[model samples]
Target: MRRLPMSLLRVLWVATAMFASGSALAASCAWPDWDHFRQNTVSADGRVIDASTPEQVTVSEGQAYALFFALVANDRATFDRLLNWTQNNLAQGDLTQHLPAWHWGRREAKPGDTTPSWGVLDSNPASDADIWIAYTLLEAGRLWHERSYTALGTVLARSIVAKETAMLPGLGRTVLPGPVGFHPQDDAWRLNPSYVPLQVMHHLASALPEQPEWKAMLDSSAKLVTGTAPHGYSPDWVIYRSGKGFGPDEATKAESAYNAIRVYLWAGMLAADAPGRAAALDAFRPLADFVAAHGFPPERVDTQTGTPGSNAGNAGFSVAVAPYLAALGRSDLAQAQVQRSRSLATQSPLGYYSQVLVLFGLGYLDGLYRFDADGAVVPAWTSTCPAPR
Candidate 1:
């Protein structure tokens, strides 16, 4: 065989190298769904509003999740906007001194007030959102090499521990649903199992090892997540008795609804080898089984009776459960969920909650990022792109 000219070989080699580099960059930097979400759901000031309704309210949860998405996309500008908005509007301009309020929106004009006022509707801070916000900030600091982000995250995490966690009789350090109203009585506390994502707890622990409560909270979080789902479906809220442990909360009628849907999503998004992955997946197996058998999730389920309501869960449910199914090696069922999510997204515009769920579950399945065993974010860009100059 005749050899190619040296000049031609060099050109081919350079072209191949460029193509490989471009492919890696594309894999790392590509996030079309995030672009859509930013354009449709997020405001210029970085508030993630629920446009499905007329209120145009912003929740701390929305802001927190958006911050995480922005971090994964490596969009520092958007992340900063979100943080600044949260601090200024929700936390009274000082995150270090106060937990951000959970709700902010326009209110009706009061006596002597002509124009409607827009501000914090509820000053009560949601611990779930608080934790997620801290996690994102910490990860951003590490990934972006910004000390300010890390310091802010550390302060937020410390505040969460101080105000939102309790040392339960049997459960050790447990996370409360919010700063108030969760403690209904002296002997009991209301807790949302879905409020504490294990990965978030783990990440915080890894980041702030000095705070022993973070590690202890991880153990309690695992127990809370698994023990509450006795029949393999998580409850929206549960009450922790001083000595008896978890039981369904009276307020929610033992129904597993929208809030509990995230339990499966969190489990599904765990690194395949992450700690508690097996037990977590096993605990929520019934949800996976239900989706596999019914072709969709139930809109609501009686956790005590295991009777599913007539209404089917939306595309968000399918999307949220997809990663868990995939993690369980049920690729076929997982793919079905993805297709259902796509079909639902095309049928009509997804609301804020559904859109967030889809972004998280599908984003994980698509290799956008992964939470390491220690709960640190490992975005694809880590391997594809060099550090910022």
Candidate 2:
């Protein structure tokens, strides 16, 4: 465990004291970006809302990211608030017992109902969100010295191993995107590269040595990233058959877009000694090169032909690749992308997805936090600075 600095201790108090008023977080200097997100995207009740949708949907992905960001900010009050709301509303009041539903928001009442209701819009749970939430809880527990958080995280991780994974014909155990609907045929199982972050897998293995499944997944997840991105560009979705191995998913036409973007982000933030770091960096070099040649990233790429589409990516895409470029020692390009991202943000307000990407990309570039060799979170706020010269 690390000691919190006096400056950050003040920020924590500000965060907790303003729990009812929801005002002080905006004024904290620990992380200005986090302050903006806490004020804008997260609701007073702790739900992270994608305000663009008609239903104003609340995805488990958003909630999970918020938990992580709060932890990085050393704002335990917000983290617990977010966790409590997720358990009570999305997980049927017991996150350890049930995987939180991936989708929740305003819902129109069924036939004979008096008015539209707000509840679980979809019962299916997203595995990415589950993994992130479990990881966040485990880290929070260790950092805060809270046994309850650790116990809950352990159960959630075990539940994930039990319910969200499947044994492939030759690949051993691999994580599915969700519990259902991914296996469309007898031989085929659909998977998302973004869903299996190797860094996260590494931490899980170290943290839960008893769960051998986490250890095996390190290779399987690495294969998913390298195998699917045959042209050095990851696809949003891919399929693995009993004998055929990895193939493009027709459902998504094998496009590399929003979902695939995350994978590069995950790989970029990997610790130098983390498993599969070298291969992951090499496999996705083409995307980074494209950004280097051009000023921005491609909005879409044909994963098969290595051909980038005509449209350029949004501000989020540019910023999201900052870590990737920095990882490759392209400091010049990294700074350029971050500058472009900020300029774009000034032109127009960023939406939820762009907002989160900026947080992840900019946060890492700014030294707010990093993942260690053991896959544990190393937030900047946890440690004090050196004595002034």
Q: Give the TM-score (vs. native) of candidate 1.
A: 0.91
Residues 244-358 of candidate 2: C-alpha lDDT, one tens digit per residue: 8999889888999999999989989999888678999999899888998999999999998899999999999998988988998899999999999999999999999999999
Model 2 misplacement above 4 A: 1-29, 109-115, 385-389
Q: Would you list the C-alpha lDDT of every candidate in the order shown? A: 0.87, 0.88
Assess candidate 1 and give its lDDT: 0.87
- Candidate 2 residue 289 C-alpha distance from true site, Å: 1.4
Best by lDDT: 2
| Cα lDDT for residue 44, candidate 1 | 95
Clashing pairs in 2: none
Cα-based lDDT at residue 132, candidate 1 = 97
RMSD of 2: 5.7
Inter-residue clash pairs, candidate 1: none
